[model samples]
Target: MSYLDPETSKKLVPIGRFMGEHFTGGNWTELGFLTGCDSIVQNHPRLLRSLSFGDDDYPEACLAVVGSMVRNDPDNLKLIEDYIIEHFSESGPNISTIPGLGPTIRFSPTVFKVPTHPQDAKLVAVMMPFGPSFAGVYEAIKSACSQTQWFYAQRADDIWKDTTIIQDVFDLIFRSQIVVCDYTGRNPNVFYEAGIAHTLGKTVIPITQNSADVPSDVMHHRYLTYLNNGEGLNHLTLTLAQRLRTLDPTLAQFA
Candidate 1:
């Protein structure tokens, strides 16, 4: 049997019935059901409590149902959005929200605003000189996103034809609560941005693909190292995840 609430389960009835009729029906492992249990459960607890349908097991069951739909039907993006929004809000039994839900799955504007709750979180800025070399940038981004609201300001080329762009980049850096700088190439522009972020009192995370690439002056600062091969991406993810936990204990695990 499905683990979602009867109402939400109804939205998935067609698909479930179709699978039942054409495919051999199997069981949903309890452990698998909770794996993708919407991240919002931890983010918003009020909604979970409000939506609980009397039975104490309803919340977990609802979460498992939503997780199953999301994992099984990637193309049915609307359903996933509905699940996220529904869980994000503590609104009553009736509320008009997210017209086409899926399209609204993007980050909420409030997440960009200054954090009110200590855990509402700080903004993290990233300074990566050579974008192409940092495949782990994606994972690092995911790690940051999980821990705090962040914006990425990457310098594509050190030589900018228009100096005005430098100011724009500086604005992004200064607005950030923390700055992560990748010094894999000893790129001067990156060091410049790092110095600016440091002056502005933004926490700076200095990392390099190799320790040898670290600039002499910044060498005293601890740096994360990785091999340029595939393993580099994994190392970056794990290291960044650990560092992010230090930044925010609430995000000790993957968000």
Candidate 2:
């Protein structure tokens, strides 16, 4: 796609790569402000200086008032976010998986756009909980991975001691087509992240260990629940294969 400017590019595309994970956290409101501020200081230094107090009788009060106005003004935030979202493509996949998989079972999704043409097939992300629940779901994830080529990565935590990792996670989800969540533990962050992913129009795959962990809002939605054992692993794999068939016809071969 053609872009009119760098700002437009940042707003339109899902974050593919980043300097690090230290610049995450906050809502769109905060991101817009930061981007705007950075753009101004970098591109319009003279205008930025003009806003500050130097050799003037009005004191720093004038600059402080403008700062307050920018802070309290809803329009400013809206403008930035609108711009960001406007140029962005509303397509891609989302996977919600737990963090840190050493010798234990691990899962990740890796996605890339089909360069020659566009298709409806999506890049899916998987989110799972830690501990025994993940052990139970490990085979299921492996099955899912085998069926498709999804973008994969371990969730970033602290990025050079600068930003929260989820900020980057949100950035990734923005470009995704669907989100798969493993709610076996009823993790607060997983639930919260799933909400955000849903709000952004990502299709959500809500999986749980049992009915107890499933939220009432999503209880009505069909989900995959597996027991903890070798039998459970086999069942989960089969169930996931079937689900994949329904999601994408190409997945039928794998099923």
Please give the TM-score that candidate 2 achieves against the real structure.
Answer: 0.46
- Estimate the overall C-alpha local distance difference test score of candidate 1: 0.50
All models, RMSD in angstroms: 15.3, 16.9
Instruction: Please provide, for model 2 over 1-255, each residue's C-alpha lDDT reduced to its tens digit, 9 standing for 90 to 100.
Output: 111233323322222111011122232225435545433333433322433433232223223322332344423423433333333324322122211111222223243222222222354556566565465475566566465554222322312222545655565554444566878768987897788666555667777777899889978888888776778878877776566555452332233
lDDT string for model 1 (159-194, tens) is 343346565456556445567787877788888888
If scored against the real structure, what TM-score would every candidate get? 0.44, 0.46
Report the CA-based lDDT of candidate 2 relative to the real structure.
0.47
